[model samples]
Target: GGSASSGQVSRGGGGSCAFGGMGGGGRGVYAPTHVRSPLSPQQVTAEIKRAQSVVEVLRVHKRFRSAFNYIHLSATWNVLGRLAARAPAWLQQHAASAGALREDTHRLLCELDAQGLSNVAHGMAKARVTSRDMWAASW
Candidate 1:
């Protein structure tokens, strides 16, 4: 471990990361962090932090998954589709899927004639009948 040095880490190499070789090879005799060994304490901490971040991101997506605002935020899907025309097949597929899903949802919800879903609960007595016998669930 004498080959290692202890001091504040600094940016180095024109096209390198603070802790890893170019292209994130993540190698060097001396680790960028102070912790050492196979299960180095620093690596463990970074891993835990990364896991937590992923969990948090998933949580937020879950909460907003059904929100119309997020789904129809902008012409983003449409733009993606048009721009993906010359892109790779995978990207084109992604854009197409997004646009299709958005359109399908927009059509399905068209049964309820309103700019958007309201987050209020109206009494059963006030329920409006618009079809043979259908009721839109309140959010």
Candidate 2:
């Protein structure tokens, strides 16, 4: 896992991006993300909302994906605003006390910040945010 590329942006993970030599010796290994479609603005929004809902649902219900999505849809509409805007305070206050729930909330925020769109990146940036509250809560 070297880097994931939607062509527009790429974040490296570990390994060299190419499969072969950059020295022009062998064939190159095309990254998987290079071949796949980047998530759309709509998709980003959806996922962000999903991540937020997952944390909230997990906090109370302690369920997995199916239950999380159910709670998420029932929770609210403006997923990004609802999720991203509300996270900071809760993350600060509760994350320290809550454990895994706190970590989930923190991660949700961070993912949102990194991927969240606001008419930037063609609005494709709108997505899940992972927060730093995880560290605070984990400790």
Candidate 3:
């Protein structure tokens, strides 16, 4: 089973991430190296709010994507858009994060508000994730 060795981030069970190529290869769901306990939605939101850098936001983003519900989804997109604007270069460097956000956005599109839709558009534009699926999903 794969584990987070030498500061690498490990992906959980039944999930794939580009962060370290460590996904279902593990025996079971691999908790991320940083998370000691499961984080609540409020905590995840606070973490996003408190984040000062792209890396910080991205580190917890997967967790947030999984944990967020209808009420928090809009703020999530808004924060992601703000983060994209603040660190466009970092967003490019960590493009996988954007992809995850895009996939989740598509899956949860019906749950988002108008502001969330706008923020998703703004953030995806900032990340240059202009794929046909994204366009189709928007319409």
Tens digits of per-residue lDDT for model 3 on 66-139?
55443344455556656666666664577687567656554444433445556666765664445543344544
Clashes of each: 0, 18, 0
Q: What's the C-alpha lDDT at position 106 in model 3?
A: 49
Better by lDDT, candidate 2 or 1: 2
lDDT winner, 2 or 3: 3
lDDT of 1 by residue, 10-114 (tens): 234653433233312213322344322354444433332333232332233233333322113222222323333334242233444333433433332322212
What is the TM-score (0 to 1) of candidate 1?
0.21
Q: Using TM-score as the measure, what is the rank order of every candidate, best first?
A: 3, 2, 1
lDDT at position 12, candidate 3: 33
lDDT for each residue of candidate 2 in 23-134, tens digit (9 for 90 to 100): 1111122212222225443443355445654255334323332222211222322342354444534434554333543333322221122232122222111222234424
Ranking by lDDT: 3, 2, 1
TM-score of 3: 0.53
lDDT values of the candidates? 0.29, 0.31, 0.53
Per-model TM-score, in order, reads: 0.21, 0.25, 0.53
